[model samples]
Target: MVTLLEHCRIGPPSAAAEVSLPVTFFDMIWLYFHPIQRLLFYEFSCSNSHFLETIVPNLKASLSLTLKHFTPLAGNLVHPLIGSSKPVFQYKPGDSVSLTTAEANEAFDFNYLTGNQPRDSDDFYGFVPELPPEKIELDSKIIPLLALQVTLFPNAGICIGFTNHHSIGDASSIVGFIKAWSSVTKFVGDEQFLSGNSLPFYDRSVIKDPSGLATKFWNQMSIFKIESLPLNFPTNKVRATYILLESDIKKLKDLVIFKRPTLVHASSFTVTTAYVWTCLVKATAATTGDETDGEGTEYFAFAVDARRRLNPPAPPTYFGNCLGLVYTESTHEQLKGNDGFLIAAELIGELISKKVNNKEEILKDAENWISYFGELLNERISGVAGSPKFDLYDIDYGWGNPKKFESVSIDGDGSMSLCKSREFEGGLEIGLSLSKPKMDAFAPIFFGGLHADDSMPINPKENF
Candidate 1:
């Protein structure tokens, strides 16, 4: 069990002025999507008194100072009630972010929560705070952009949880905020030593939507009431962590090339996602038998950061969302067959190569994204949450590198999270949420395929 200790409001330092930022087309894609929730565990054994006196105060102060630079985070997304006006992030003088403090009972096992083994998905909900409910104010709807929680495990470590509305920012923007907050904490709330180059660029005008995609996307949001979207996660799911060492990725790449010699883009991201997608397909077929009809389409979707791809490339630190979707689909039979891995890898690699090379094509289909995603909402689709490029393990708040980082939002959808390995260089960590039966069937298929000889075929039925 977990008990709430305090609920405090934190804002930027005194003298910080109000600011407003226009929402871009990229941001509208996630306007009605579920919020992104994450947990970062740090192992620092300390008494409750010491944690309250030192850690709590330090984190609160550092976050306040950090918000002075990232003002939008402490603000709210104001969606205009009038049909003509677009949504914008508005920060008033008294605007602040919610910070909750909680303590977990002794029964909670810190090690088990941070380990690679499967654990109850509900165990993580306590650490993550929820975004404030949307409110109607004046002529606009006010939605909180970010909320945070710090949970103490008594003599064990502490867990820092973050829940942010997807419309406010993407992973890159959030990571930048954490880096700034951590830097401030490490230096004891000192901002002088912080690097200016690392600061976020909040100029939304840099994102050019030549096709008027923003207005088009805003019109699509009317199709469904935002309140109707699913926010409650499934309780029967179990969360697990899986690792792919450097050698495993190399072997997977080699296998793809051997099967499809013309394959041009077999990077770590492509191969890892392809392999996981194929494994999930087979696992679902083996355990649930829901999409085994061979004719059903299995879709794989993920977002690509378009910061550098934009014309007159936006700064690397450009805040808010600058992403494009890469959606690919295949028949169930094609994905669960003997050559499924190779097929997935080739399709992903080809699509990625095309998008990476042709910048003009990135937003060509932006208008159809909502409808496309809506169609696949309840279908046999799988998506990815985090990216290996984030290097999340490197985030240190003076306590040390994170013991474990998880994207808890994956439980809502059948998506997975990927990040660079914490202990191994060039390795990758994949976080998965599935029912017990599916997870049991997935382990062998995932590990057995990695260990199998090059000439041998991986039979999911045999493994099960």
Candidate 2:
């Protein structure tokens, strides 16, 4: 029998046992490929400025738990079944180091699900798995896998990498888990290990029992992408900015109320997505030779979460394909003709609330969207040329809160933007991706809205 305080005591144990469970081929595949599907990823490198320090290592005794200790904990969400479910661990770990580099050497292989071959062959589950420690420039790179380096620069000058893979968890869960991991670090004192006994409720699958309610929302899903390659990136790096401020949000709220006279309330995501789409439309249009007018090239993607909408709403933890897409279409000419920004914003909000609040559509959407992804990547349609996926607004890390936020881990092929709320302030943070050529054209449009307030700097490009 397990006791409360007895189990509450934390730290490494003398010994451990084994655990394992079976996972569906489908879930495993999903976890690896679209690891950061609905999440925001950023790519940032350390600066060459001053500031130096060294990490004092506890170069003492140690015990390293490998696949064995994790043996018994398999077959569910916890066990990312990429490798065999066998459990193993060692009495000691090998070369420990400080300051690990966190950059991926390759672009993401996006065509996993639809293609063929053995189920496990397309595996991509686990994260970069190496969490290296870092110190100021004074010290040399030493840490093992956790080779991470961060330095704060004055005037919004710091690059950060934020990676949230879909398999390990969602954006919400990603931050939550990171906090948990941080608390267990040696620097934090008596480390706390979330015991392997914490069993997960693995029955949260939407496709288990599909009904008419899940069938109706099929047509609502559309793939979101932006035209690309018109410009190339310098040094092969993908970078972006995402922010959302209180004042701007209020303005958006007021605009939504004025335009959608029928709706009692408009969700923030809906309104924001509309504005983002509008910006993308305008930016693409401006790049066009007036004659083309941003035709066939302006489209945006929004998510339709399928939790509270089904006949019987999903469980509180139903975290699988609970998301589908809502696509919007317009040329720069059409979007700019009227108060398209406001109109589009209001429409986006309603589209979100309507589809998310409805269940019948989500299930059908999941099935069809997966199928559509198959067609697009299959090269049947020219869809994958360069898709710009905009992730949700993310801003919940619990320390005193971050001084700055950035998306650092995107396969950053074309352009993907993530919107973030500014820390301890009133303004917004927007993370946007652009082709090298397009960056010059896009920067002015983004700063124009945020810097509208005179007290704010005239140009944030240097800071951004």
lDDT of each: 0.87, 0.36
- Let me know the TM-score candidate 2 reaches against the reference structure: 0.56
lDDT of 2 at 31: 34
Report how far off residue 452 is in candidate 2 (Å): 8.3
Tens digits of per-residue lDDT for model 2, 1-464: 11111101111233443222222222322332322322222222223232122111210111122111221211123321234332111112122212212222223322221121112211221112223222322222211111222222222222222233343333333343333333333333323434523222334443344343222222221232221222222334334454455555666676678767776446555555566556655565566644553344355454444445655665544423344445544555666545766666655555555655556544444545444443333221111111122112232211223333333333333324344443425444444444444455556665575455454334353325
Give the alpha carbon lDDT tens digit for every residue of 36-57 in model 1.
Answer: 9999999988789988899999
lDDT of 1 at 236: 88
Cα displacement (angstroms), candidate 2, residue 349, comes to 1.7
Cα-based TM-score, every candidate: 0.95, 0.56
